[model samples]
Target: MTPKEAIRLAINGRTDIGQVRDENEDHIGWYNHPSLPMGFVVIADGMGGYTGGSKASQIAVKCVTEHLETLPTSTFQACTPDQQLLVIHSKILDALNAANAGILDAKVSAPQLANMGSTIVLALVWQDKVTIAHLGDSRAYLWNKDGLCQLTSDHSLVQEMIDSGSLTVTQARSSRVRNHITRALGVTEFIEPNINTYALIQNSLLMLCSDGLTEYLDHGELEFVLSTHRPALECCYRFISEANEMGGKDNISVGIIEYTLENKVSVSQANISVPAPSSAPVEDVTVRKESRA
Candidate 1:
């Protein structure tokens, strides 16, 4: 079954190799535990060369999503309502660290791939709350009646330039160092992933994606896309298609979680009931599109 049909909370995701890249170095996905109410949405953008970038991105997604999905549901369910959010935060943080370590470990024998690293953004979605942990430049955004609000701060040099008043937002868009991220998975022995938890209002849409989509569509264009009021899957496809239309400068990936009344749980409740799932989780399959040169 497709993610729209099989994934909980109307979650769906898609990724593309883009027009230029020989291999897709981006990964996007969301998967829930076999019996837990929580789900994980991860986006990773890889850098380096010699085919190592793709592997790094794949390792990032695999490490974070697999580790988080298998977390003990009973431990989460057993927590007090107030402690549940904390548990979510810790779980996401721990998983991100693990992903960082996994990427470092993969470089053990391959000397040429030593510089390979990846940007990551992971959202742990539960009832009315999303705890995000990220490193490097992949981002998380929430779109609602209020419009699109960027949920994650980029860990790129351009971002630092913007923060330090050295580069205006417009200038940063075209800055030579825009792609030079300040940090990434496997770059350091210990990683400090940024973490934040947000209250998800009903009808709000949470999007996790790589920089390729953002490089093309600005906030206004994204608003226009959402104004179509399309289903989660359609909106995600629009994101990928539009980015490709804009010259697909890099690999593109998108994962969306639409929070509606149906997915909302009571504030007092620590966990929601999840229907039984099969032995293996269903993955969203993406077709890599080739550009017409």
Candidate 2:
């Protein structure tokens, strides 16, 4: 169990023997480091042949967790809003690169795994800051003053249709193309993931999950449930249960984060600060060429 502090988290995850497959190919993990109240939540949904799909998702979670462990602990100790965002952006990019490589390496040994890939969504919270980075269809949602806001975009064909106005939300529900994802870890040699950073105050909750959960619930439904829930963990439990009741067609994973309001602290009493950088921007190299007919 991860030692939770500022945000107490309760996690509930299950893989279903849905209408199609024999095993669920999803992986999830959550932990709070002893060095700080900050914690991380990760979920990966795999696709490919038998052994290959499972390994791809497992490798994704391991790679991300290992990369986070190597970062300087000071990054999470507490800092100005800008500094926190910089640290998060840099670290997330590094982890995604590593996870991509891990999947590719696995493919080299087993050629059948060449197309093995997984969708990943990872969220980190340290004090009042929240950061999310994702690839593929896994998502993150926040229940706050503005209501439920989806923080990650789906990288699937159905999502593209919705974005392009070719399909309405109702049409997407039954679209055979709903499962076609545009991106994944080992499907290609390189991947550029989306990273998001935001600030959180009191009365905020975050939901990190795979499509198994979101595919069944609308934004308004989730908001009302999460807002009225008890422990953060129970919220996760209910979400999964509801999804299963509707149709547990895939693996389910969820991570919840609830921020407790901290008393207002004066600037002088804050524990950390970020100093401005002193170096100037570096210039890019260029070469000129002339052509003659």
Candidate 3:
């Protein structure tokens, strides 16, 4: 009889105030134990150009991480794949909802903080799969030797226009209303996040970041740097530097979790068509969250 081995991860995260912002409104929550059955990395960007954006980001990260850790760790580590997904899926929603409630409640206690909100993105690694969820423009990306796949889409007015063919990617990048978002954590009574999961692919690197990083760099530029497959720390450093170099007009934040399975082959799945870099960004053909290895 053979025994199963635990999966390993190289996790790294960083947030910068950037050259333009006087305050670093971004907050990060990361549990980067090298060997763990489950863990997560979360990043929230304060609604830039608004009062209390920084404080709102702080509260959002704190609420989500604190609420998510309330899960049944022992059961999560030992449950069947189907059961694990159910547990984590429910937890992610609960945590996000708690974060929203926490922020709204804060507004009632302190009216000065009203209208403040933040964009959130989270990546949860449980067993051998990564489940992701987000609101607003914060993003999650999956990268390996094959290429980069953008997992989450932006929740912004400009993005809505882009989706409806009213604007192109290039125009959206240069739009004066680029930072305006349609959804956030503390602004309103209701907010729903987009969530998905994928089987853990060995040598796969998951990256999460604020719109600051995405602002200066697009998908093609990101894939170029990640293609090197450098250690998570170095890659993060480069990401920040590049963003700053390209007119770091806003706060820059990033989190990287590179996965590796010692002495084991990568998880195999059906019908993943990831293409090489081209004029257009890589297409997403990765497996879904419900599908386990």
The lDDT of each candidate is: 0.73, 0.70, 0.76
Per-residue lDDT of candidate 1, residues 1-293 (tens digit)? 01222234667899998899889988776885554445778999998885888889888888787777766577766776558776766666666677777788888868788989999988877655677777888887777775666777788899878778898878877888989998788787767677766655445677888999989887677767866757665788899999999999899998887765543343322343221222211122221211111
Model 2 misplaced regions, further than 4 Å: 1-20, 75-81, 264-293
Best candidate, TM-score-wise? 3
**lDDT per residue (tens digit) for residues 1-293 in model 3:** 01135466777889988988888989988886444555689999986345578878888899788867666477666786677678887888777777777777877887887777889999987656778888888988888777788877788889889878999999999999998888778776666677777766556788899998998898888888888746655788899999999889889899988777766555653222233324332223222222111
| Cα deviation of 203, candidate 3, in Å | 1.2
Candidate 2 lDDT over residue span 1-293, tens digit each = 11234344333444444444567788887766564557778889888968777899999999888877655465444565557567777777777777888888888988978778999988887655667788888888777665677777787898878878999878887899888999777777667677756656445677888888877887667877887787655787888888888878777777776655544432221332221111111111221111111
Clashing pairs in 3: 197-289
Model 3 scores a TM of: 0.87
Candidate 1 clashes between residue pairs 3 or more apart in a chain or in different chains: none
Per-model TM against the reference: 0.84, 0.81, 0.87
Error of 3 at 188 (Å): 1.8
Candidate 3, 93: how far from true, in Å?
Answer: 0.8
CA-only RMSD, every prediction: 10.1, 9.1, 5.0
